[model samples]
Target chain A: MENEIAMEDKNSTFVVLPAYNEATRIRPVLEDIARKGYNMVLVNDGSSDNTLEVIKQVKKEFPDKIHIFSLLINRGVGIATQTGFEAVLKFNPKYIVSMDSDGQHSADDLDEVIKPLVTGEAQAVIGVRPFKDMPKSRSFANSIMNILTRIFYRVNVSDSQTGFRAITVEALDKISINATGYLISSEFIREINDNNIPFAEVPIQTIYTPETQAKGTNVKVAFKILLQMIKHQF
Target chain B: MYLYALIFPIISIIAIIWFITRYFKGKNSLITVVLWSIFWIIVSLFAIFPNVSSAFARLFGITRGLDFVIILVFVVLFYTVLKLYFIVDKMQNEINTLVKELALKNEISLDDEEE
Candidate 1:
């Protein structure tokens, strides 16, 4: 299994993380992924905090392993993540993985999250968590979004909100991420479903803290996502 | 009333003169100048001869000329508004494309890490 993985890593691959004002939480997250020896791209989404300063420190330590793109303005998660893709495409990487910068997603799940793709079982892989302890309003909102995804996009993944996802270069080159906001999660599913790209999910753990909870899923933002989903119904 | 009659003709004349100057200065397109000229001419004619609108209304079997004029005004406004919306949307899309291209160009590759 180890030898098989070395051969897979020989191909161009990268992990992209979208961060916004996560100056304090990003250190452990980047360090964990770097220790795993994966080429990474950290796209700072115009963070007002010392996030870019921290990113600069990481780049200094692992200059050859990590690439950075500091967006001059806060565009949103969709565009920031898209910028990550644009940067990774320059290296002609075959597999591109996207993860969060809030330290919620673990680097340990990277192998399993990309497992289905490694075995040729699926073109895309996403992380899933039960969220049994998830707050009431947040869980209810996720349930509503999950149902809407199934009803419209025909995607039945256990978790659609997880940012930890892997996709093939084929999927990336074909689908365009133009939503320009947080709606990219559902928009991502919509594209995969409409393009008939096979996908699977691996169960993963989510470590929530007061910081993560403070950045809750907002109702107004969710409404905007719904409107965009309806407008661009796949 | 005489005041009502003179008011529209005066406004129509001013608009027509303004449009002509704009067209000559290249601030307005030829089609725009022609369209507005025709619109103001008709307005001034209707104001000068109020019976013509009623006559045309009678010919078309409409209830009243004022109603027909009001309906025409709304239809033109709606059509122009829709056209403006498309123009603005196209401009916005163009700007987004340029931003993407420039952002990609400005990307810092790991190979070129600062020394």
Candidate 2:
């Protein structure tokens, strides 16, 4: 009876990770998360590489420390994250945290992102990556998106594009998500604005790799973000 | 005959215009409106103008330009729907990936020692 009650209370928080082609680093990520004492979900976005192999290995070693969702085909990051959220809802977790699988976000920073959602101070808690690690052009683009989000939605968010965020199940239920691709970030801000949901941001560290720096947001993604925002602005 | 043809086309034209207006207002997909309007135009041309109908039959190996237009619109609409379906499919794929990851995490967290 005591264990049953404890299990019911245990579903208060969940850590969601969306991974694609991150075999080289996923094992270490899972290891690091294993030390943090939080539930972890890894969404493999249909990688065409050894990502699944690594996940299989991790599952064998830490069967309870890691869970893997191997997609049959590649889906965009937004959809993967949303699907994770919907699944976690069944557990009735009070707070949900979304982190990147590429090692860009630190598991240590999970507390900062989950604070607001857990405390009832804000409906959403976002991890704002320090501008120092980002390229100037990317920073400029994010700033523009933030400004636009504020001007159009009357809300101020430090980082609208950051993958690290936390929100309550209630907020998750209220927020609308229509985007399937890269534009989901903009759609998130739009939904939050349209619904007038309360949100806050905490500064978090960003780790950069040679590949991540080289693979910054492209023109096509930028244009998509702009078009998505324009669609909702009217 | 002329009056009947004119009236049918006019009504279709009005419907097309209304649909286009709604599309411009972001109430519908633009491609949807264009596809439907093109359909109505072809129907109107064949039904209202017999000279055009007969000219089309004589000039080309076609029987009715209006019928051709209907087939063309359906083809275009079919393609458009297919393309949109793929987009939705892709989106659903992402959602599935995310859900699977979450399920795995929930399972692991059960044994997570942080409590």
Candidate 3:
């Protein structure tokens, strides 16, 4: 069953889910993707809970639509997503779409983002959430990240921190990344800018759960990203 | 009896320090020190104060003072494994990001060639 599922993923677009200690929400997200007929790779980022166990159970139930990779220790979200990104690279997918597993990102918006990648209109496409659904604090943080990317990377992206993004396997290979959390999303955009990969943004609806609102952007996270940008400068 | 009591505790204390120093110098040396210290402590206790050694050993479930050293070594080993796991996890992510970015660039070059 695993081999058959692996073969199925070889010919399809890949969705990457970077999850950590999200045993409660991950299963529903996995089921949503399976229903959409899109193959996904869930990177279990060293979650101390039953996150890996949940994925194993899902794999047993829906072997073809979901594949998983587990890291032994809890790394940050950036590392977990990168693990999924690497696995998708091996499968040779048409497009790679990565989203969070905390139930903040909608699997339904995937098509809107993947469209550009599928049509070759852009090398990478990001789904930007409308401001109405975003908290004021988060909106402000996103603006700060965008301005920083423009200053360092010279590219003007609407929302640099949005996780709903799709890129071709080719672009995924070229950009060098140096992030392990929220900053990774920004660094990815900077990579697209550095390499001059054509990128597009499509407006999508984002529903902010209580969990997401509580976990909103912070100054420490911003500082970590600034440090990452400094490292890139050198 | 008085002389034996004073010398035995002193010897045990010295043996424990020596065991810890060897443990710090190299991990491999810890096993040797622990084993030999356990042997010596047990022998000294029997020769000097058999009743006290037997009573302490039964209460602690450790045959000798040196057996406690082996337990300490296991604790350190477990902590080391947990620390290494975290470091490895972080490093793998950094490497993966590097690879993905490299792949992304290669795709751009291919696109340029087609253009």
Q: Give the winner by TM-score.
A: 1
Q: What ranking emerges by lDDT with the best candidate at the front? A: 1, 3, 2
Which of the two candidates, 1 or 2, achieves a greater DockQ against the reference?
1
Q: Tell me how far the alpha carbon of residue B114 in candidate 1 is from the true structure, in angstroms, after superposition.
A: 6.7
- Write one digit per residue (lDDT tens) for candidate 1, span A1-234: 324555446345699988899999998898887777778888888789999888878877877677888777677888889889888988778788998889888888887777787778999887886668677776777777777778767888777666788998888887877867777887788788778889888888887888876663556666777787787754
What DockQ do you compute for every candidate structure? 0.29, 0.15, 0.03
Q: What TM-score does structure 1 among the candidates reach?
A: 0.78
Alpha-carbon deviation at B81 in model 2, angstroms: 11
TM-score of 2: 0.65
lDDT of 3 by residue, A1-234 (tens): 223333343347888988788888788888877776788888777688888778777777777677667665666777767767777776668788888787788777767777777667899988887865678777777778788888877778888878888888889888876577777888888888889899999887777887766553555666677777876687
**What lDDT does each candidate get?**
0.79, 0.71, 0.73
A79 Cα displacement, candidate 1 (Å): 2.0
To one decimal, what is the Cα RMSD in angstroms of model 2 from the true structure?
A: 10.9
Q: How good is the docking of model 1, as DockQ?
A: 0.29
Which scores higher on TM-score, 1 or 3? 1
